[model samples]
Target: MAAVDTTLRRTLIEYGQTTLAVVVLLVGWEVLCNVLSVPKWLLPAPSQIAADTWEIRAVLPMHFGATLAAVVGGFVLAIVTGIPIAVLVVYSPFLRRVIFPFLLTLQSVPKVALAPLLLLWIGYGLHSNMIVAATVAFFPIVINTATGLESVDKELLELTRSLDASTARVFWCVRLPWALPYIFSSLKVAITLAVIGAVVAEFVGSDKGLGYLILTSSGAMKTSVMFGVLLLLSLLGIASFYAVAWAERRLCPWYLPTNTDPPAI
Candidate 1:
């Protein structure tokens, strides 16, 4: 009970600090906008963004839902595809030699540049958005998981081999568990990339989602609406990141965030 109370107090304090910082920033921004007589087209104030948010509340949800769906689909696809392939790269010399160079080449090519190809093949839809988002999030998961799998202590593996442990036992008991931190770290990064990927895909080809709305707002010079969309996008990224982080905590209770409390999740 005492520990719970302490945790509650700390949470309140942290939230208070965050709220204060946001308030100060908004107040300063509102003042600067007025003092400079900033054109609404150039920079809408926080109040203007809030007003725009309220005005578009109905449509915002639909756009937000679409974007969220794409991010989720892409993020899940990356995880399912990436981790197994990474394991293959770690375990198979032949596959490592063949696949790694191709992966690097693919990564080097800009995803936005592939927008036209995606549109040509997938044709401006949710699948295209998922592909784009998956492309953006794929590399980190591969790299991190591969590193973790390869970085297992050599001595430990030798001991397991000496014990005549089965290959699956060695992997489950030693390799995969040890790689959880790396996997989760990549997931956190991947979630953010997924959001960006969805937006980028929407920017070029789609008529729905936050990216499309932001593009539309820009064309109309509705800076306030753009700001609102930006805020919504940022919020989406933050929420997704924390959700991954929460999973990390559950999967890896031994690991703790640097300079912070263990996440409740």
Candidate 2:
């Protein structure tokens, strides 16, 4: 009962803080717009954005689906490919020494600048978008997985060795479990990056997706619609983040419990 009460209290406090911050932001935005006489075209009020959301409800879902597909597809690809590569790198010191520098260089390259080239090569649409998204997210997963695998305590390794554990057994029983947290942390970061990548690809070349809507709306000075699309993008990011968080909670229940308290009324 005490633990439950404490958890509830913490959740309520967090909810109140979030609500306060949002209220403050909206109030400031409303005041600033009125005082500065900001043109609707330049900066539509929050209400206008809300109205625009309803106005575009019909088409918004289609665009959202397009972007979501790219993000999820690419993220899955990154995880599948990156994990194996990370395992290889971690298991082989020679491979790690030889490839780590190249991996760093590849990661440092500006993916946005390469978007056009990707479009040119893949010839637009979902393939190009997925490629870009996967590229953007791949490095983090690789780095995280490698870090997790390598992070196995030396003492743990020695103990396993003393027990005459095989390399595969050590990895499955000791290293992989130890690395799960780090892998999930990287995944959270990668998911957001995947969304950004999909949006960038849409901006560069695509008839569909939120990024394309943003481009079209901005060009036509449909500020309200632009705001709507931006809102959708923000929601997408939040949804992806929370999805990962939920998965972490389920898969790693030993790590932490979900805070379930409601805000004080």
Q: Best TM-score goes to which candidate?
A: 1
Error of 2 at 33 (Å): 2.6
Q: Please, what are the lDDT tens digits per residue for candidate 2 over residues 1-265?
A: 9988888888788889999999999989988988899999989988878887788889988999999999998889889988998999988999989988988987888999989998998898887898899989999999999999988899988999899999988988889989898889999999999999999999999999999999999998899899889888999989998999889877777666456445446
Give the distance in Å from residue 156's predicted Cα in candidate 1 to where it truly belongs. 1.3
TM agreement with the true structure for every prediction: 0.92, 0.88
Q: What is the lDDT of candidate 1?
A: 0.92
Clashing pairs in 2: none
Range of the 10 consecutive residues with the lowest summed lDDT in candidate 2: 256-265
